[model samples]
Target chain A: MKLSEDEIRRITLTAINEMGDDATPELVKKAVSRAVSKLDTQPDFSKSTSSNQGRLILTSFGLNQTGVVAKITTELSECGCDLQDISQKLMDDFYTLIVIVDISGSSKNMSEIQEKMNKIAEALKIKIYLQHEEIFRQMHRI
Target chain B: MPFEFEEILETIKMTEIEHFDIRTVTMGISLRDCVDRNIEVTKQKMYDKILKYGSNHVKYAQEVEKRYGISIANKRISITPLSIPLDAFKWEDFVEVAKTLDKAAAEIGIDYLAGYSALVQKGFTNGELELLKSIPYTLSETKRICSSVNVASTKAGINIDAINLVAEAIKKTAEMTKDQDSIGCAKFVCFANAVEDNPFVAGAFHGISEPEVVLNVGISGPGVVLDAIKAAGSCDMNHLADVIKRTVFKITRAGELLGRKVAEQHGIPFGIVDVSLAPTPAEGDSIGDILMAMGLADIGGPGTTAALALLNDSVKKAGLMASTNVGGMSGAFIPVSEDQGMIRAVENGSLCIEKLEAMTCVCSVGLDMIAVPGDTTAATIAGVIADEAAIGIINDKTTAVRIIPAYGKKVGDSVDYGGLLGKAPIMSVRNINCSTFMGRGGRFPAPTRSLTN
Candidate 1:
């Protein structure tokens, strides 16, 4: 539970409620729970248990283990990150991990987590960057 | 009054409409260098390339999508024609590349990969011959890598010898992937004339004449067309034709204007606007649905060919009338997996290759996304290619085949192309072999000229 469970429920319900006026609280609660469950089941985020989600990918310097991709995915997941969609490929030895992750649930200090992830990158010897998902999607638009 | 007629024409031209937007921005990448002398290295190379290029496309396309209101339906990619690279390496290496492509695509948001291809039309390039030999392995190794053998092309003419090879390869590829779920690989396209800038899968690859990297959008909206057609009703066929023409004209205009805007926003010259009514899994927007709405209960049933022909003619008439910007095959696509209505008909034993071939007389890309048995021969595949090409030549239209022979699939099986193309039960091919005719290796004379000297 990144934010308080109550707050999480409130925000999700608000979104679902706003989507349609007749949207039931039960339906909103259920959809948000399901979405959270999906996020929880993600490969990297599955093991994480953080009350305050805090992280930002500062830069991604090509993939090294899957190449460097695991580090990026793990660092974000550890801080409660959710990937919306990703379309990446391998080119020679330098692995590139281009992805669009939704970090909206993280209510903790985002800059702190970003610095922490940068430190993690420094430790793991990988490059990671922090950019919005909207930017990521636009870059790939055809 | 005559001057008023011109004003009305201008007003009609100014009547702009917008519907659905582009979904995926698919970027095709060549996986050739990824192949290595060692099978393991080749596999590794294959895996590595998909992850790299796929991510690049996602990152770039999203930026463009926000600028233009057109939402990319899918973020996708295609690869280079694989036979040359595979022949330069080994057949098994093709499998490695397929695996790489599949995994890489999985990592990125890209749903499909094109360019698992072989060119057999102008006799077999050494790479193509090797590719023909490796169909089963290639089919079995990768989940997403689509395969297509060019059995006939306008520039290369028809190579009956290679066509024979394709029929054999079709069977082998079908068998290899049967257990893995019939793959979404677009396997074969018969082309009377092939364009260089197509952006659809199972068939999209950068031809030699392609720019460094071009952007093209395949705007699909059969739902919009069908709604308009339904409003028009069943009348004398010619009357319906006029209605269809007007509707297609409007639809093409919408696609062209959007395509141009998106290209401009991206700082890339807008290539061609493919005004094809590509169907999806949705109920309202299928080409098959439109056909049935035209009075045929079954897609490949009795009047299917006639309906398809009219649809084709009217779409072209309207599309040509709408925009000078049309480039790709600008007609309806008849892929079984993409249209739910099509899948239902096939599952009910209502459609067959015979009827589908008949319909190919009018389709933009000939015989797209067809799945066949594993034992089908490349020669038979070649025969199928030639049959489709014959229609295109006679009509002087661009037709392509993106056939996927499920490696181990048999008649009456099924596959899901996922996303926009959707899923469909596998339709069976007529159990006929064509080795003899394909063995006759020569070009059919070009179609008769239309203009008088």
Candidate 2:
């Protein structure tokens, strides 16, 4: 079952009210998606798995500007990389972008993708780092 | 599963803002099979084996760095003590072997190659004696080869004779490299109870009991721990310990992950993850800074030892919980010259040699990277070594002395070595002579604590 934008927003608001001041935006989204995906109806998207198939993380930091997301997403899609989740914030006058990507369908290996991303990062005047998803899980989950 | 956004941000900040990094990935290869009665054959075999095993080491490490986005600062190699395999060789032959090791290290693009060393804790064979005699020349002649001499252990007692020999050799090394601020001594260490799998240079060597090949990882992040403590503002002692422990746990886990990956790539066994907070000369990356953050006015002031004791214990506890194989001096390292806060303390007269000795009793290694006056006598250096050895013996811990006697430089004159070895300010030593004590030359018996049998 695919939930409408309004339904997702209502579920997030309900989660926020239940969780009080401690309910972060990420937490609210996670809770609502988890509950909705647990129902008998099939969700529109596949759930995350522990497989090593094209899983990666990309982080970028630089001056805030317009069209940053559009340019990055366009380049990512061209490389056959799918953006799983993305979070962006402007703090202390600089923009920070954290993205989780699935690259199993990509035409390039990790190093090749890194080389392409390096060119884009340089063109955009930002510093970009690409890492495997296992680093995050090994460091944070256990 | 999706990673927590805060956790990913924290990891990035630790590497970018803070100076957290993998200090070294040292491959220890046993050279026992290279032994030959013919010195030339021995040297040839040694060089061939190192080149064969170490050819792709730097490339593989770089590939891993790019894949994981973690920086590995140094790629180094350690071999079985040269004295063991080259027992029949003379001092000149040993120098040739040192040159071979140095050339191989340079060819492989590694920064340092250790194990130009001798283990004379109980007594010295003729080869060990010759190796000790060749150390000053070996260190002065080569650029990448490091030397270490283990003169004492808990079960073997202090080898005063070997300590005296090393003291004289250190003086000679300083005199030979006087043009470069006596920098040759920086690559030398005298240890009590040295471990085989230590990944840090100037002290690492493949032990006889180890396998043919192993990979040991040394992870360092004094800056990360300092940031964690600052984040937990005004917490009590127990809470402070918890903060440090949790932070170190994360650091060690990251190191373990990298170690396993690197070892698997190289087709070698993962030895251990050394969770030592080895500091560099950068700002905010000092062990002394961590102590100051923990409420010490100065690194050598009152309560300094207690603070260091707490920090060291907490690091070990967390590392044990995080890693399956935690070994090789796994605690906080307080190398004076390498830590900017430590250098500042010495310059301001708040820290002194004696206080550093006291602090070493509770820390990872003892009296590291210190520089004393150039005119300091060999007997006096031996006195310093003897004191550190006694501490290690009684406590059954690893202690080492890597002091530099900056030739023709007096107290307050600093010697700058520039990179990770950093700078050293010549500090005052005791004026009293200990020649008679050093001249006694007899071994100090094993301490009562070694009677665990």
Candidate 3:
């Protein structure tokens, strides 16, 4: 399905923020274009993600507040989320963030990781959602 | 924003770093090639050879040190130990030879002279034994010359037979120069395969294989690097590594520039640039002080080994990056008595031979500036030198020993060498006598069997 300009802006901002780039319109556009181009030629990268760990692609939204998206990082660490990579974007308001966490072999199950993340979002009142690294790759297609 | 040079530049404004220029550029010349039959002709040939090759050194070093704003300390020369046995006429023949060397050095404006040596290891030759017997008088009579004798080597073992001989030499030399009130020990050195092109003395002796005339540059800038490390205080591993690499890069540049200029002007082979932290008799500039400032208050303590190892690595890496001709004992020196920090530690009973051995594990060279009891047997000294050489062979690094068995000097007493060599506190040695082990003349091949890699 063809996405609207607003939907592309939101996705691009979140992806740029996830890639630890500035959350400006220009940075988001650049990161989105680069990531999309890379996703086309790259293989499935299935084995790149270690077997004992769970992966998450973190992205920042364009609808967020003026403050930084620090809580997700804090909550992830608290829940024993071993961060493998990070991407982020910052703007006037509504920052976007994307991060990959490895929960491989952790005693705390997926529910615990999500529960802490939910509490952080409710407390700080910032939006956060997750997708597997593979689906994120597909959605990030050019 | 760029780095704020506010603090460092301000300190630079306050301190006068270029206080004294290098007083001497001593080109260590070897006499191994000058050996031949006929005593008078050989003596004449030795003088001709030294004057012919080394005359240009003083003129060139003075010009270069002037150009660079660094003072050319001294323009001097060190020859291979004359091995008096080469001239078997009498003790007087050895003394005359010293005079001839003095004349040759003076002719070149090289006031400081060394290489008046006696190799009495294993056993002295007929002429060597007599010449070694008469070195103190020979040294006292000479005008401006320094000397050394390698009474011990890993291959030759130790010549315990020369203990009483050297003891007599020291006392007489001290007595002969006592009226003149000059430091006599500065004229002599104890060696363990002494390095070629070493700019330091009286330990500076030309190795046999060197080109008759060559320029070796001993680059020293410990204060510079120590300041850099302290600036990166308490950083993580990566940051610490960065600070070390940057500081080394700068100092090595200074050494290479000065060393090359001296070689070219003198029209000699630029032998090697030794990037060693050669400590002077200065108060705060000592290598030991740098280590102590790094958290080991006394150099022989627990943190000592790690500190020395870091120092050695940083110096070599920086020098290697700075120039291609990296040679000599390009490591940190741990000479006691020479550095103020070492003397203080030894006097307070905080440093000893065992701790020095451990420091050797981290720093460069073996037990240096060690002062043993006067009554120490020849065999004991040889044993000590062997143990040090073993460390060098096993680790595949160049190490040396320059011990002083001060005559009539007991442990706990301090012997003063005044300037440069500084003053030494009497350090006692373990009473164990390993003469039997040292007497066995053979090579202990590198410890290859122990290495898993």
| Model 1 chain A worst lDDT run, 10 consecutive residues | A133-142
| Candidate 2 error regions (>4 Å) | A1-53, A90-93, B450-453
Tens digits of lDDT, candidate 1, B1-453? 111222222222222122344533445455555556776776666666566334555544554443222356765566667776667755665565667667777777666676777666566666677776766676566555556666555555666666556656555555555554545244444455666556776666656555534456676767766766787886878888887787667556555654554444334455666767788777766889889888887887788888988988788887777777676667888887777788788888888878887787767777767777655666667767788877765666676666766665577666665666566565566657666766777756555556623
**TM-score of model 1's chain A:** 0.46
* B359: Cα error in model 2, Å: 0.5
Q: Measured by C-alpha RMSD in angstroms, how accurate is candidate 3? A: 25.1
Give me candidate 3's TM-score against the actual structure.
0.64
lDDT of each: 0.62, 0.90, 0.63
Q: Which scores greater on lDDT, model 2 or model 3?
A: 2
Per-prediction DockQ comes to: 0.01, 0.23, 0.01
* Weakest 10 consecutive residues of candidate 3 chain B by summed lDDT: B1-10
lDDT of 3 at A115: 59
In model 2 chain A, which range of ten residues has the least summed lDDT? A43-52
What is the docking quality class of candidate 1? incorrect
Candidate ranking under DockQ, highest first, comes to 2, 1, 3
Per-candidate TM-scores read: 0.63, 0.90, 0.64
Per residue, candidate 1 scores C-alpha lDDT tens digits across A21-51 of 7777787777777677765665541122321
lDDT score at residue A139, model 2, on the 0-100 scale: 88
Taking the tens digit of each residue's C-alpha lDDT, what string does model 2 give over B278-392? 9999999999999999988888999999999999999999999998899999999999899999999999999999999999899999999999999999999999999999999
Q: Which segments of candidate 1 are over 4 A away from where they belong?
A: A1-142, B1-24, B28-56, B63-70, B83-87, B92-108, B184-192, B234-239, B253-267, B301-303, B347-350, B371-382, B402-423, B426-429, B439-453
Q: Candidate 3 lDDT, tens digit per residue, A1-142? A: 3443445776666685676644677766777777666556755422212223456444435466544456677667766778777666566765656666677646565545655666667766765554334322221221
